[model samples]
Target: MSSISIRKAVLSDLETLLELEQGVIKAERPLDPFLGKGELNYYNIPEMISNKNTHLLVAIVNNEVVASGYVRVENSKIYHKNVKHGYIGFMFVKENFRGQRISNLILDSLKNWAKENSLKELRLDVYSNNTGAIKAYERFGFTKSLVNMRTEI
Candidate 1:
């Protein structure tokens, strides 16, 4: 076991983050049939790092990035109780680092940032069939809220 540290992501971390992004997509492709085949990206690293509303974070062990996640302030729906909430995404932990609670540390930091910025709630989406991820999120205090359904016409 090695010491793990969490910090705000910087532009210099982009390359490693890109690799982690591929890890996330590869793990998810099997669970999501709607995802396009071939290379795809779910985030803009530079913009995310520069955006005041988003808090991107990375976990490092022995100076190597091993996990990553982010939370962004977003407007709640009109029917929702809160005015704004933190939308979490891009959660990934390298396969070698799995089950070590690195993701929990990232989530803690994101949750604290949301609290400091006055966000009342935090929300995220996970593939319903990704039970492993869902369990992890649930253990971190997230509850299942909504289920989205789709049909191909």
Candidate 2:
């Protein structure tokens, strides 16, 4: 395994991040027609990187981004009990980079950043169908807390 360096993402990394996000959508949610499309504007690399409440981390191997993840801070009165809660999202690693422990490195960096910012707890929403992600999160001490449901109008 080559040395993997985790670092905070910068504006210069926007293009690479966009490609990685598209790759993840295609790989992880192939059945969804909107996977690689511009359906969810929030995933836009430039916007996400510039968002004050979001922290993006990238894992580089041989000076190339092999994995990435982010934590988005959601300010809401509903989370008053945990005033500084962060929502983890968009975790992805290139297919060839799997099994290299890159994900762990990226996650560790994100957690460290959260700690520095005085965050109390981290939360995320995973599709029930993504068992692999669920298992991975469990390994990092994340457990199922609540199940959310939605209906299309």
Candidate 3:
């Protein structure tokens, strides 16, 4: 059992982060085919890395990137217009690292980051077919706030 450490991602970690994003895209595309054809647009790696409202956490095992997740603050446009919520996304753990509680560690780090940013609530979206992730999020005190539906013409 190797030691796993979680920390804020830096510019020097961009290459590893992109690689991890590739892995994430590969796993998620099938769950949501319309997600595009190839690698995900992780928005802007540099901006995400430097943004104060966004926290990117990387999990390293023996100095190698094994998993990552991020949480960012977002404004509420309606019911909670006065507050900002924390949205968690880009969660992925290497295949070999599954079942080792790596996801929990990443989630915890993201939650702490949200708290530090003064977010009122934390939210995330999971594919309906991804049962494992859904269960994990539930265990972390997340509930199904809404359902997203799509139809193809």
Best by TM-score: 1
lDDT of each: 0.96, 0.80, 0.87
Clashes of each: 0, 0, 0
- Alpha-carbon RMSD, each predicted model: 0.6, 2.5, 1.5
> TM-score, each model?
0.98, 0.86, 0.93
Model 2 residue 124 lDDT score: 85
**Consecutive 10-residue window with the lowest summed lDDT within model 3:** 36-45
TM-score of 1: 0.98
- Candidate 3's residue-wise lDDT over 1-153, tens digit each? 999999999999898888888887888878986786644675587899899888988999999989989998898767775578998998989898899999899999898878877776888889989999999999889998778999988
Order candidates by TM-score, high to low: 1, 3, 2
- After superposing candidate 2, which stretches have Cα over 4 Å from the reference? 31-42, 151-153
Off-target runs (Cα >4 Å) in candidate 3 are: none
Instruction: Record all residue pairs in model 2 with backbone atoms less than 3 Å apart, i.e. clashing.
Output: none
Model 1: ten consecutive residues of lowest lDDT: 144-153
Spell out the clash pairs found in candidate 1: none
Clashing pairs for model 3 are: none
Output the worst ten-in-a-row residue range by lDDT, candidate 2: 33-42
